[model samples]
Target: MRLNNKVIIVTGSCTGIGKAIALRCVAEGASVVVHGLEQDLGEAVINEIEKDKGVLQIEEITNEGAPERLVELAVKTFGKLDAVVNNAAMILSSNMETTDLAFLRKVLDVNTVAPFALIKAAFPYLAKEGGCVLNIGSVNAWSGEPNLFAYSVSKGALMTMTRNLGDTLFRESGVRVNQINPGWVLTETEIQRKRSQGLKDDWYKDISSVYAPAGRILWPSEIAAAAIYWLANESGPISGQVVDLEQYPLIGRNPPKN
Candidate 1:
């Protein structure tokens, strides 16, 4: 068990990539604090893992005191916190015209500010144990699609925060901070998002080569597998790194017109 006796707090774990990470952490012997806004879904995650290996926390990531509440839950339930997986985010589609100041602030609240708050709340515990922070970011942090203006901006800020803190926090307290920027991942929310956008039920089945070079998008489990490396001690002495997990070079890649 690579994470034997570790305690991890995985935000937004009720579904999708966060859920996959939580399940994987438990399998690797780390007790987890599974968190999300949906109560039933959070409970479903709890049911899948042994009762003793996982617990649930339901709260919007941007709510006042939410970070402290989550940190409190992890420490109260597991006695300490070994890692924090900043996986919760608000991914809204909007162009510059639609992204008003309020809209941008809301997106930043969940996608950028909340992660920093959680890290600050958990810093003391993480420092004590030489733990780490794994932020789930996106390739969109690099300019992003035209439709995702606010979302892309928030992630870009998050990327900078990761780099800034990954170095400062690691040097100050031996607590590593890193980020993984995943490409298109086929998660439940994406299924619903695409459907809501008027795509067909099987929209993901036939992605163009430009978007999915392997004939399909990435999976949550694949992202979770990669996450384990950063969370585990095996990623020794490494900090302030942003890894982009995508099928193709996100920059300057020309897709075949054929």
Candidate 2:
């Protein structure tokens, strides 16, 4: 196993991309700590991992000292922390002109501030173990999306944080930091939302024709594969880079050609 004996924490892992990353980590022989707000969903993920005989832990990380609590729990249960995937965030549809201050603050608090706090809190353990940090950013960070203003800004800040932390750790400590920017993913929620909005199979065709160069939306498992590679592989030399999950052939590329 690539991640044999490694200990990792994945936040917001109850569902979506985070869940996929946690499952992948467990498969790679790493003891995983699953953190999220939903107790039932978090437990379900833990159960899934446990069924495979993978050692796992669970925690509900909210605004109050969640990052510290998660790190402390990992150390207490597993004895050490090796990697952390800061994959927790919220996606809201609101532009600058229409978005309220409360909404903007909430989005930043969850998407940007929390990741930084977790990284800072986990720094000591990561430094000791020469571990790495993988942040789940978004393609919106680079593109100008109209309605997802707060989300885009938060992810943009996350990319900057990744670079800044990676440089600091590279120079001062052995810990590595990187970011993963996923494009439009077909999660369960998205699928259901599409259906609710009366979007049928042809909607997918429309989306593919419009956005994805590969003619398909990204799957959570694909993003998970990237996360696993960054965590399990000795690819520390490539730290501070943002891995875009969109099937575009170039960075900042969008609106796939027909």
TM-score: which candidate is best?
1
RMSD values for the candidates in order, in angstroms, are 0.7, 2.5
lDDT of 2 by residue, 1-258 (tens): 888889898988889999999988888888888887777887888888855333334543445777898888888888999999999888767887888898888889889998888888999999999899999999889853787899899999999999998888877987889998998898766677577768894566566445676788999999998888789666846788888787664454455455
Model 1: worst 10 consecutive residues (lDDT sum): 249-258
Give the residue spans of candidate 2 off by over 4 A.
Answer: 51-62, 193-206, 249-258
> Clashing residue pairs, candidate 1?
none
TM, every model: 0.99, 0.90
Which whole-number lDDT from 0 to 100 does residue 127 have in model 2?
Answer: 90
lDDT of 1 by residue, 112-147 (tens): 999999999999999999999999999999989899
The top-ranked prediction according to lDDT is 1
Local distance difference test scores for all models = 0.96, 0.83
